[model samples]
Each structure stands twice: as structure tokens, then as C-alpha cells.
Target: MKKLSMLLLASALALSLAACGQGKQTGGVKEPAQAQQGDTGKAPQATSKKTTYPLTLKDSSGKEFTFAKAPERIVSLSPTETEVLFAIGLGDKIVGVSDLDDYPAEAKSKPKMGNLQGNPEAIIAANPDIVFAGLSLNKNSVTKLNELKLNLFQTNPKTIDEAIDRVLLLGVITDKQDQAEQVAGQMKKEKQQVVDALKGLKPEQKKKVYIEFSPGWTVGKGEYLDDMIAIAGGVNVASDLQGWKQISEEKVIQANPDVIFFAKGVPNLEKTIRERSGWDKIAAIQGGKVVGLDDNLMSRPGPRITKALVDMAKALYPELVK
Candidate 1:
């Protein structure tokens, strides 16, 4: 009876161990498959959270610019770019500005890097991620900075449309696209309104204009000023000239403009024209059709151009404005 009992006990113990082994196998097989499914579900979530970089581009003047990443600190080599940055609500990101950037009252507090010929060392010390320069910047200076792997944007805006485009570009770089769009939109609307208001006038009624800078210095044909004058309901008398050139009194007399625009504060302008030798023979001088343009507003590439255009339109077409 004891031997029989031992055999039965052995069989029971073996069966119990067998069952435990099966349970362990079942758990091990199921756990990995369930965990793998859980891991697969999480992978897409992480991938979707990835951040994108900003776009990179080269300006019209061949300066390389990257906007794929938002820069924490920026420098403006051109006064116009500095003013543009501030205009686009990037005052906080601007660490340094050129001396000529004086429009925004808040910009005065920022460090000035002198003029467009600003010291590169001062700019480097600022540790800016991006730099803005005008197309007129000395090429050697721009090349030196570029060799150091510094990103730069060179703007050369010759027309009002180009100026507005610069503002939009700055906004994109600084992450202020909405505000920039709004400001540019308003300027465009105001400009278009002025253009539409004067569209009804006859060509004969339109005055022929000549923009005189100095005794001999005058805007050539196809310049931005010429475009502005045409848009303001005046014909450019010097449109025949090749480019910005020094015109002789004979040329001015031959053009016979009905109106003359003199940029304000030009040295020896009034005195020179008064003694212009043969300038009085021109119809503009004889008819008192000379108008002076504010240097600050008309000369810079900014929102002020819109104001300049509107003012010029009103001045040239007083009857239309009324």
C-alpha cells in the first residue's frame, strides 16, 4: 500500500509541474505581442510632434538668408532694414541697429552700429543669428561676414512695391507675418485709393514733371521717382534719359516740363537754379511749377513712400482731391 501511495504522489506532483510550465509559456508568449502593439501605437505620436524649420532663400543681391529657424538675436546693417524690423514688431529681437535707423522711438535705446559701414566687430560681438544689410553694402564686408557662416539678407528696394515686399519678408523672418500683412495691406489700399481718385483726369490736364536734385543732378528715366511721379498723375519729362544722369540746361529746356520737383536741402540748389545760366528758359521755371519734396519721407524705402505718393498726388491734382 505504501509503494502504491508513493507512485500516485509522484504522478500528481509531475502533472502539477507540467501545468505550471504551460502557464509560464502562455504568459511569456502573450506579453511580448501585447507590448509590441503598444510600442507600435506610440511611434506615430512621437513622429507627429516633430518641429519644422523655417524657409531659407537668397535675396535679389545674392545674399544668403535662412528663416527656417527663428533667431533669438538679430542685427540690422541698413537703416531701412532696422526700421523695417521695428515696423514688423521685431523690436525685442533686434540686438543692434545702424545709426541711420531713427524712425521708431523705441529703437533709439538699442545699440547703434554707426552707419551702413558699421563695424563688423561690433556686430559679431552681439552674437546675432541673422544680419540685415542693404544692397549697397560694401561687398568685401558682406563676404567677410558670410565666410564666418553668418546668415545675411540684402535688400535693394527700388520701387514702392519692392519696399512693401521687404516689410513682408522681414515679418516672415521674425514670425510676425500677420502684423506685417496688415500694415502692408493698409498702405496698399491707401495708395490704390489715391490712384483710383485721379484716374478720371485727362492726359492734357496731367502735368509733365521733372525731378531735379541739383543744378545738374536729375533723376534719369525709368527710376522709382519717375514711377512715383507717373502714379501721382504726372508725366516724367526726363523719361528719355538712359538712367540717373547729369542733365544740361539744354536738356531741361527741351523737355519743357510743366512741373519741377526739387528734393529739399540740396546744396546750392535754389541759388544754382536762380543762376542756372539758361535754366529760366524752361517752362517749369517760368510757370512757377517747382515743388520741394521732404528728404526724410520721399527718399527712404519704408511706409513713408505711401505718404509721399499721396501727398504728391494731392499736390499735383488739387482739383481731384477736393
Candidate 2:
């Protein structure tokens, strides 16, 4: 029971903070063409276009933040933001990171100030020109930071496309436009790759998918994971529900997903899920199609999201994707 609760809290922290809106179920995202790959696998040298200064843009919160020039010092309270910042070549400008922002190796050595519930004084003391935050930040923390006049830029990306948009937006504000575009281009290519692979799949061929981010918890319609399932050429059986919600075993038995995916950290994922009472008749359990996906890749809404998308497609249509 304790472990299940912990998993639920963790899922909320990882997703509820970053995702906005219920599942839009766009089927699949049709992104613009990816940038032509260079000989070095880098985004080809982009034209020297600069983000003219005195720039103003809105964060996911719809709050406008203006920058006189590129911010020299930065603080990030979201792990996804940390990854995006690094992807855009802004690692050196980071002054502080949340305790949990361990990624890309370099972030591990960054000054650990706080996370969603970080102390306002420590962040203010870091003297960061801007702080990247998300909905995970405690209401008290946000209030205090707002009172202190901190430049808190909250990012809420509900879908893979919006996540890519965030990468482009961060690049523009920090004067790393080329790097950001390259990252976005790569994401688009990844998305297109999965789409191309599933082109021959008919609506009838699409599998019914059920994903458990945590024990007793599953994503339904209007959530990022549900959309990912659609993009990967499958339908979320729980699409009838909305957002992240606790699911009942009876529901799983009735919906009978063709494939089931769970967060990877759990031990004996297949056995654990298969043994659930009344689940013996489930198609996924009988066919041994239970899959364990990397929790981090499944959770974070950043450059790695497409990796999850690719993974989901591979799991559903292994013969096609490979």
C-alpha cells in the first residue's frame, strides 16, 4: 500500500506538474519536416539569425517575461527544464538546480538549491536572472517567489508538440536559437520516424493499449501518454476517462488492453501485473505483452519524450517499427 502511494505521488510530481489540459487525442502529431541532417549529424549551420534584444514572451502560465538581454545566471526547478536548457547549450549559464535535476552528467555538479518546494531565500540568494519552474512548485513557494519579484517562468506542456515548442522558446530567450532549432528538428524527425513506420497500419490493426504509470494509476484520454498511444498506432482503452486517475482491476478486465506498459523501476512488472485478481483473462496477460518502460523517459516532457513515443510504437507494433 505504501509503495503504491509513493508511486502515485511520484507520477503526480513528474506529470501533473508539467502536463496541462486533458487529452486532446490528436491521433498523431504531424510536425513540419525535420532539418536536413548534416554530415556531422548536427543541425546544419543555420543562417545567422539573432534574437533581437528587449525580447518579451509568455510562459505556459500566460505570464509575460521580458529579457533585456540573455540572462547570465539561471535557476531551474524542473528536471525537464534542466535537460532542455542543456540541450540548447546553456549549461554554463545555470547557477542553481533542483535537488532532483540529475541528467546530462553536468547537472549533477550544479549547485543544489531546491526543487518544486525550494526555499525562496536560497533561490533569491543565487541571484539568478531567471528561474524555470512548473506547476509542481508549492503554492506557498510560488507566492513567496512572486512576492520577492523573482522572474519565475512556468512551463506547462501537455503534448509532445508543445514540449518541442518549449525547447524552441527556451532557445530564443537564451540566445541559443540554433541549438534549440536543432533539438526541435531532431524531435520532429523522431516523431516522423514513428509515423512513417506505422503508415501501413489500418484503424482496425491498431492495438488497444493500457499504461500504468504507477500501481493502481493509469493515464486516460486528454493526457500526454494517451496521445502517445494514439501516435504510436494504438488506442488507449482508458480514453474514456480523463487525465491521470486511479483505475480499477474490473475496468482492466473489461477493457482488456492488447498490450500493457508500466514504469520500469518496479520489479517483476509482468508477473506483478499478470497476477492481479481477475486479470488472468486479459489479453495482455495471456499473450505476455506486458512491457516495462523507462520511468524517466515516460515521465519527463522534454527532448526524451520522442524516445518514449518510439518505445511505445515499438512495443505495440514490434514487427513494423523495427
TM-score of each: 0.77, 0.85
Off by over 4 Å in 2: 1-46, 267-270
Question: Per-residue CA lDDT of candidate 1, range 97-131, in tens?
Answer: 87756677887888887666567778888888888
Best by TM-score: 2
User: Model 1: which residue pairs collide?
Assistant: 54-68
**True-vs-predicted CA distance for residue 250, candidate 2, Å:** 0.9
Overall lDDT per candidate, in order of appearance: 0.65, 0.77
RMSD of 1: 26.9
Cα lDDT tens digits for candidate 2, 1-322: 3343222222221122134332222111123355688688787543544666677555665666668888899998877788899989999999998787778799999988765566687898899999887765667887888899999887766677777877877776787877888998999999999999999999999898999877778887765677789999998989989877888989989998999999877666656787899898999888999899887778777888899899999998989997
Top lDDT prediction, candidate number? 2
